[model samples]
Target: MKIAWLTLCAPLLLSACTSTQTVGYGPNLEPIPGSITYGGQPRTKLTKAPVGSIVPHQFFDDFGHRVYETYVIEPDRSLRLTSRRIDYDIFND
Candidate 1:
């Protein structure tokens, strides 16, 4: 009887020890990539910009949806946006 009880309770105890918590951004909360800037300058890089170099930029928007833009460094040390996209929540779908 004790062996049978242990077998049944073992699964329950192991399951309880496991965590189902989610980490990082949720499905609804997505990350939007913004433009890239080097130092305090916009569309400008301190070093020579390569064709496929990436720069990081941060900004906040008033809208609820997340807005992001991606920029690629040009040979001229300038930044150009390759593409832009927006993430929004839709109801009544």
Candidate 2:
């Protein structure tokens, strides 16, 4: 019984480990006003930076909030924003 169960589960476990998740922009990944890719990816594609390399950008949003963003270069030579942080400047107000 145990041998049969292991045989049944082995392929499932190995398949799970072998699956690769593709990273790309989705509906929820809409860029903000001051983002680098806000108006869509630049006509000039990155060549020197290898795929999976991280690029950081800082800018002030339309609301005057400091925004820090981290992006990764995809296989297609496009930048994909992976993480973002906003500084509200609570004390400055």
Candidate 3:
């Protein structure tokens, strides 16, 4: 009787230990080349974008740190990078 009860509860207990949330940004954007370079390197390449368009970019460093950047495309096809934090709140209120 005890073994049967344990078997049923074991799966439930182990499921909570699993990491359901994945690291880094979601599967929507791609990383920019040479963006993860060191400080002494040249200026990072700016992604091209059309006017009034928002582009999302992700960067990963050697220390496993991730950065999410949003760029607003100017009228001249220049990208303006912003380091704004994204809100993960499900409810706006």
Candidate 4:
């Protein structure tokens, strides 16, 4: 019974933090990815994403200085970092 309980909960524990979350348009002004403008009006209405797109991406500040790279944060508070210069797949290839 104890083994069964641990087996059932193991998947639940692992699944939650297996994803990446993104922060956009804060002090680090990454280009609003997938952003669209409603061009038919006098005022352009911008539609911004809530973050976390797996799209090959990059970041910059409002002043256009490259600052951070996208990453997945582990539940243990470790970083799985990504960047244009470092292709993680290169090793696999």
lDDT of each: 0.50, 0.77, 0.49, 0.37
Tally clashes: model 4.
0
Cα lDDT for residue 23, candidate 3: 31
Q: Which tens-of-lDDT digit does each residue in 8-77 have in candidate 2? A: 9999977754332232344356678888899999789999999999999888777666777788899999
Best by TM-score: 2
> For residues 26-49, what per-residue lDDT tens digits would candidate 3 score against the true structure?
334343443432233235444554
Tell me the tens digit of each residue's lDDT in model 1 across 1-93.
999999999988877543332212322333343325324336435485557686544353355444455555667666655544544444311
Worst 10 residues of 3 by lDDT: 84-93
Residue 26's lDDT within candidate 1 is: 22
Off by over 4 Å in 4: 21-55, 58-93
lDDT of 4 by residue, 1-91 (tens): 9999999999987765343334443333322322211132124222343234332334443433333454433343333344322122212
State candidate 1's TM-score.
0.41
Among all windows of ten consecutive residues in candidate 1, which has the lowest summed lDDT?
Answer: 18-27
Question: How high is each candidate's TM-score?
Answer: 0.41, 0.66, 0.38, 0.26
